[model samples]
Target chain A: MFRYILRRILYMAVTLFIIATVSFFLMKMLPGSPLKAEDKLSEEQREIVLEKYGLNDPVPVQYVRYIGGLVKGDLGISFTFDNTPVTKILMDRIGPSAQLGAQALLIGTFLGILLGLIAAISHNGALDYTSTILAVLGTSIPSFVFAGLLQRYLAVEWELFPVALWGTFEHTILPTVALMIFPMATAARFTRTEMIEVMGSNFITTARAKGVSEYGIIFKHGLRNALIPLVTVMGPMAVSLMTGTLVIEKIFAVPGIGEQFVTSVMVNDYPTIMGTTLLFAFLFVLIILVIDLLYVLIDPRIRLTGGES
Target chain B: MSKLLEVKDLKVSFNTYNGEVQAVRGVTFDLNKGETLAIVGESGSGKSVTSMALMQLLPKPHGYVKSGEILFEGEDIVKKSTRDMQKIRGKDISMVFQDPMSSLNPTMKIGNQIMEGLIKHQNMNRTNARKKAVELLELVGIPHPETRLNQYPHQFSGGMRQRVVVAIALACNPKILIADEPTTALDVTIQAQILELMKDIQKETDSAIIFITHDLGVVANVADRVAVMYAGKIVEIGTTDDIFYNAKHPYTWGLLGSMPTLDSDEEELFAIPGSPPDLLNPPKGDAFAPRNEFALEIDTVMEPPMFKVSDTHYAATWLLHEDAPKIEPPESVQRRMQGFSNTGSKDGEK
Candidate 1:
């Protein structure tokens, strides 16, 4: 298992390097510079400004220097955002996104699985139809639309939550819910499908023959097997939530990295954009590794490696 | 002998997209307290349906007993509610399913699988259940029972997993064990061992076993009585001797002819002429008539009643009518019947 993890970390490093390289070049390739506002400057004056930021250097040289900065754990300085260090900016913005994502993840997975179990156990019944419809709606309706609806109804009309912004726990509720819908729906659909299959498996019949309580058979045996596939689907998704929901964070004014990511890209803030992309890619690979480990944890049949002897 | 289970005209069917599938059509049988009754048939022959109906584990609300009386200890299990069936299952009646590969939950520990029944039905605490589970693993011939208990099903081989399944079924000393082709998925040598284990367990517990399998060769090893099912109905049922030697139904003859006896030196093994009839729209008369070479003219229009051959033997065949022509069983069947006796004498009851 140790060797397997080490090998995965190596692969993760390679993957992040490639993502960083691609996003760096992709950002550099875009027209219009971070100096779009400086276009009317006198040629001599523009040169001074470019030289000050080392923008006068060739692209390859800039890439090398950027890579050097990366190795030293410095994401360079953001061109926007008062020239703050990109890493510090990312760290500062992480808390709200992480909290919202974690809350949504915990509540979404639990409720989705519960709803899915009810649907599968009462298959073809009213609850099954209800869950199916809800899954379809959740997948179809965009989170921003749901955000608007939640604001209008939940905050504006019902006065249950603050309309928008990142402040109190009440303000966090609407955006967290908006961010959670997709994961919950995906979880519900997958759980329903997997649980139905698990419930029909021969072991479940064996459990039934053993006179296991309905709850025991469904929760202990059926759910454990069903959760394997659910974990697979939920892995990459969890990473996205950790990064923050771009439109959702904007709509709710949560001041998360999602808004920063967009603004950095628009102004061609190379360091900030590359840093964000790298963070996302790193989390993607890391969560995938975590998911692989989860497979071993949930199912004994899934061995990590012969190295673990 | 006292009767343990009496299934009277038990009919089962499933509601499919096409229509109602008559899986089991008015089947009747009796299981003695300590005997192994083998329900033998091809796939879709309702042998499995009979067993599932006994346990009330048929996939619902699709497969259901259309009409039946499964009398257990003088009470009809057919009328028993699902809640009541729960109490009876695992405690008084348990089952060992076919395909040990999938019958045991893969994610669960072998110990917990065995202990589940003990803790649920026997009301034993975790410690007692754990001790009993270790004993069961030992009884099933598993080595290092203590260490093996915590391992998952994947850690065990197919035969060993099947042993665990049997151990789970026997944990509470159920009075009746319905083993649905428990050895069908096992290796030939493993098959022999499992048969021996079940027989031994039966001797110790005196539990009636309703063993379902299509293998006539396997039936000879453990079954006290044999039931030949065709198209969801029992066409022939008798003692091992009656079914093997004095068989009265042509279907039974076909089944015997199909099996290869050890002493037989036939150029080719015989196969029954046609597959079993579609139960969705079962034929009018003897469901086996279309495949039966001796099918009478009246077979197409009417179903034959079970004909008594001896006190313990009966067959459902028009050939058994008193006025019917006296035609001997086919040459291949007679040769098999003779060869079986030779092998039986030589091998001393294989």
Candidate 2:
């Protein structure tokens, strides 16, 4: 198990390195330079800016310098926004995005699992059909569209909560629900299908024959076994939701990292963009590692031997 | 011995897209205390369905007990509610399924799986249940009762897993034990060992066993009485000696003849001809008339009632009628019966 974890950590490092390199080259390859308004600067000023950031050097040299900066925990400076240190900007905005994303994730996951369990246990009944229809609607409609609808109706028309922005619990409701729809739907569909299959499995029949109560049979045997596949996707889903808040945050006018990242990309803020990309990659790898560790806890059959899960 | 379980006029059917498939049609039998009653038949003959029906574990919204009364100790189990059935299951009666690999919960530990029944039905405390679980495992011939308890199902071999499943079923000391082809998925040697273990366990537990299988060879060794099922009906039922020595039904003769023996020198094995009839549109008269070489004209026109061969033996065939021509069992069947008795007498000499 120790060997397996060590190997996974090594792989994670390699993956992040490759991601950093690819994104760096891809950003450099884009049509315009980071100096968007070079015509506004004097020739000497442009030279000074370019030389200071090592942009005048060869691509390989710049790449080596970037790696050095990363090793020293120094993400250079934003090209836009008065050349703010990229790390400071990220730290400032991360709190809001993490809060919104975590809230949506918890609410979405809990409701999805509960609804799926209900649908599966009362299979082919009215509740099952209702949940199936709700899942379809949730998946088909985009979060922005759902956000628009909720803002228009629940806030503007119904006056139940504030229309936009973030502070109070009521303000978070609309955007959170909008952000939650896709994941909730995905989780619901997965849980319903897996729960149905597991409930019908032969082991479940054996449990019933062993006189396990319906509650024990459904929760202990059915739901626990069904959660394996669901857990596999949950890591990616959580990260995706956090990253996917860009459009939702803009619509809600929430001052989050997603909004900052989008603004940085639009204004050609090289350091901020690269820093956020690395942060996303790091989070992705970290969540996947945590998920791999969790598999050993969830299932007894899956043993961590050498490098195999 | 008193009757432990009596299934009367039991009929089971499945409502499919095609039509209502009559799986088991008016099957009737009784199991005595501490006796092993083997229900033998070909695939799709509803032997397993009958056993599932006995436990009220048939798949719902498709499969159901259409008409029946499963009387256990004089109480009609058919009338019991799901709640009542839940209490009865794993307490008064328990089932061991065919595939041991799929029968056990993969996520659960062996000890916990065995302890579930004791905790639920017997209401034993965790510590006592744990100790009893080890004893049950030891009872089923598993070694290292204490340490093996912590291991999961995948850690065990196929035979050992099956032994764990048996231990789970026998944990509560159920009044009736339904072993539905418990050794079907095992190797020949493991099969024999499992059969022996079951016999030993039965002697200790004194529980009536409804052994469902297609193998006559297995039936011979484990069963005290045998019921020959054909197309969801018991065509022949008798004590082991009556079925093996004084067998009367043609289907029974076909079954006994098909079994290979050490003395047999036939070029090809004798297989019972034709497939079982489709239950969706079951034959109007006798379901086995087309396959029975000894089938009479009346066999095609009407289903024959059970005819008494002796005090303890009965067969459902027109050949047993007083009006029909007197006919003896086939030469090969007689030879197999002689073989069984000769071996039996030798064992008695020992």
Candidate 3:
């Protein structure tokens, strides 16, 4: 078990390194130059800006310098955001994004699982039909579109929630819903399929034959096995929700890394863009690793010598 | 000789897109107290369906019992409500399935699976249930019962898992135990161990067992009386000696002849010709008539009613008609039957 954990950690480190390398070079490869944004600046000023950020050096040299600075916990300065260090900017916005993402995931997963259980138990009944329809709507409609609709009706007409901005928990309602739609749909569909399959398995028949109650057969025997596949997708689903919430965050003006990432990309802010990408990639990798560990916990079958794929 | 369970005119069918598949025809059997009745048949012979119907545990929306009266301890189980049925299940009657791995919940610990019935039907608390679970495990012949209780189903070997299943079935001291091909999935050595364990447990508990399988060898060892099912109906049923020695049904004869004998000089064992009739469009008369070598003209025109060969022996065959000529069995079969009877008598004497 210790060896399994050790291997997972080592794999995580390698994954992080790959993400950092890709993000660093990809930011450099974007078409627009960072200095070009300050078009009115004199030749000397432009040269000074390039020299300060080490952009005057070759790409390889700049990469080495950037990696060296990263080693020292320095994220350098944002090109377009009044010379602020990218790490400082990320630190300020991580809270709202993390909050919104966690809320969305929690609400989506809980409700999805509940709805899925109802759907599976009811089977061909109204609950199952309703859940299927809801999942379809959630998956088909994009978060941005959902956010826009919520802002128009729920916020504008009915006035159920604030239209934009992040402060109190009330401000999180629209954007969280927007962020939750896809994962909720995914969770519902996955749980429903898994639950139905598990319910049909021979073990369930064995359970029923034992004179176990229908509820016991479902929750204890059926649901536990059904959760294996759901848990497998949880890592990628969570990270996707957090990192991909940029459109929702922007529409709602929620101060998150997603919003920061949009601003960094728009202004060609090299340091901020690289930092956010690296952080998001790191978070994605970390969540996936955590999910791998969780798989072993949920189902011991995966805790075999080599570890799960 | 009081009947513990009686199944009357049981018929089970599944509704598919093409048509209704009649999996079980008018099958009837009775289990007496402390008696082990083996229902022997090839695959798709409806032995499992008959058992599942008795418990009212058939899968819904597709498969259902068309007509049946499963009287368990004098009450009609088919007419009982789901709630009443729950009270009967696990408490009065329990079942162990063919696949031990699939029969157990993979996610659950072996102990909890065993304790579930105790807590549900017996109203035992968690603490008491756990203690009883260890005892039950030990009772089923599993070692280190205390530590093993914490392990999941996957941790145990195939035979051990079956033992765990047996322990779970016996947890509430059920009156009737239905073992549906329990030893089919295990290796030969494990199969013997499970059979011995079951026989031992049966002696202690005195529970009537419905042992369903295709292996005649197992039937010879475990069954008190044997029912040979064909297509969906019981073609023959008798005491082990009666079935092996004075078997009346042609299907039963075919089955016995198909089995390999040590003394037979034939290079290859005799095999029953043709496959089981498709349940979707079964024959109008006897389902096994086309395959029976000794089939009479009436065998293809009408289904045979049960004919009593002795006080405890009965068979469904047109050849058993009163005016029908007395035909001798094959010499090879007679020789094998003599050998079997001699060995069985010796064992009984010992």
Candidate 4:
């Protein structure tokens, strides 16, 4: 198990390094320079700004320089954001995104599982139909659309909560709810399918024959097995949600890393763009490893031997 | 012996997309205390449906007991609510299903599976239940009960998993243990060992067993009385000595002929001539008529009634009627039946 984990960490490092390299080249492929974003800057000032950041250097030399900076744990200064360190800027903006994403994930997942369990247990009943319809709506309609609907209904019309922008907990509610839709849909779909299959399994019948209460059968036997696949789907979904709430952040006017990423890319802020891409890659690979380790934890049959690597 | 369970005119049906399939059509049988009664039949013969009806475990919204009275200890289980059945199940009547591979929760410890009934029905504390679980595992002949208790079902072999299944069924000391083809999914040697363990456990616990299987050979070793089911009905039911030695129904002969006796030098194994009738459009008369080589003219027109062979034996066949032409069982069937008198003492004497 230890060897397997070591191997996975190594793979994660390689994956992040590849993402960093690729995104650096991709950012360089952009047409406009960061200095162009400053329309008011004089031609001489622009040249000085360009020289100050070593914009005249060859692509290979810049790539080597970036690699050296990475080795020293430096995600160089952002070109567009007053030459601020990309890492510090990202750190400052991470708070709101994390809070919103975490809230959506926890509540959405819990409710989704609850809904899925109800749908599976009741089978083809009204509750099942309703949950299925809700899942369909959540999946088909994007989060920004949900953002629009929540804003109009809750904040503007009913006065239930704030319409937009991040300030208090009330302001966080609409954006969190909008962001929650996709995860909720994915979780519900997986849970419903898995629970239905598990409920029909021979072990469930044996549990029933053993006089296990319906509550016990659904929660203990059915849900436990169903949870395995749910986690498998949720792990990757969690990484995406944690790292990329860009559009929802834009709609809600939240100062999140996703919003910064979009702005940095638009203005050709190479350092911030690469840092964000690398961060997303790190999270994706790390979560994949966590999911694999979790399989070993939840299922007794999946023993991660040293030979697995 | 006293009656432990009485299933009268028990009918089970499944409402499919096509229509209702009468899976178990008006079946009747009785189980006596400390006795093992084996119900033998082909697939879709309704033996499994009958057993599922006993536990009310039939698939809901699709399969259900159409009509029947399952009187266990004089209480009609047919009328019991889901909640009510929960109390009776796993406590008074537990089940051991076929395929031990899938019969246990793969994620759970076998010990906890065995302890669930003790905790639920007996209200035993965790410590007491854990202790009893170890004892139950040992009772089922599983080696190293203390260590095995903590292990998951996948960690055990197929035979050992079946042993754990039996341990779970016997956890609450149920009065009736309904074993639905318990040995069907096991190897031949393991089947014999499991049968032996069950017989030994019966001696120890005296729990009545409803053994459902298609294997006549298994029936001979474990059953006190044998009930041959055909097209969701019992065509022949008699004491083990009577069924094995003086079997009457053509279906019974067909079943017996299929068994490979160690000494018999038969070149080809006998299989029933045709598949069982589809229950969605079940034949109006004898459902086995198409498959029976000796099916009489009347068998095509009318279902035969249960005709008494002796005080303890009965057969649903026109051959047992006075008007039906006289015919003997086929040569291979007779060869198999001839040796039964000396070798068929299965501890289930009526």
DockQ of each model vs. true complex: 0.84, 0.83, 0.78, 0.89
Q: What clash pairs does model 4 have?
A: none
lDDT of 3 by residue, B1-350 (tens): 89999989989999998899899998988999999999999999999988888778988888888997888888889898898888888889999899997889998888889999999998999999999999999999999999999999889999999999999999999899999999999998999899988988989999999999998878888888999999989999998778888888877877787777556676356678999999999897789989877777887888889999998999998788987777767666666677788776413522
Kindly list the per-residue Cα lDDT of model 1 for residues B1-350, writing each as its tens digit. Answer: 99999999999999999899999999999999999999999899999999999999989899999998999998999888888998899989999989999999989998999999998998999999999999998988999999999999999999999999999999999999999999999999999999989988999999999999999988888888999998899999998878887788998888898887665675478888888888789898888888888989989999999999999999999888998999899887887777666566313443
Q: List, residue by residue over B1-350, the lDDT tens digit for candidate 2.
A: 89999999999999999999999999989999999999999899899999889888999879998998999999999899999999999889999989999988999898999999999998999999999999999999999999999999999999999999889899999999999999999999999899989989998989989999999888888888999999999999998888988899999999999988767876357898999999999997889999988889998899999999998899999999999999888887888888888788323421
Worst 10 residues of 2 chain A by lDDT: A29-38
Per-residue lDDT for B1-350 in model 4, tens only? 89999999998999999999999999999999999999999898999999999999998879988888999999999899999999999999999989999999999988888888899999999999999988888788888999988898889999999998998898888899999999999999999999999988999999999999988888888888999999999999999888999999999999888887776674478888879999999998899999888988999999999999998899999998898789999987887788776654653443
Candidate 2 regions with alpha-carbon error over 4 angstroms:
A36-38, A307-309, B345-350
Per-residue accuracy of model 3 over A192-299 as CA lDDT, tens digit each: 999999999988988898898888988888888998999878887897797658888889998888998998897788888888888887788778777877777889
Better of 1 and 4 by DockQ: 4
Interface RMSD of each: 0.6, 0.7, 0.9, 0.5
Give all TM-scores, in the order shown.
0.97, 0.97, 0.96, 0.97
Kept native contacts, fraction for each prediction: 0.80, 0.75, 0.72, 0.89
Question: How does model 1 do on interface RMSD, in angstroms?
Answer: 0.6
Off by over 4 Å in 1: A240-244, B342-350
**Weakest 10 consecutive residues of candidate 2 chain B by summed lDDT:** B341-350
Q: What is the lDDT of residue B39 in candidate 3?
A: 96
A1-309: candidate 4 lDDT, tens digit per residue: 778888888888788888888888887999888776468998899889888998889998899899889878899998777868988998999898889888998888988898888888778999999999999998888788888889889888999998777788988988889888888888898899999999999999999999999999988898989999898888877875765488889888899988888888888888898888887777678778888888988898888877453
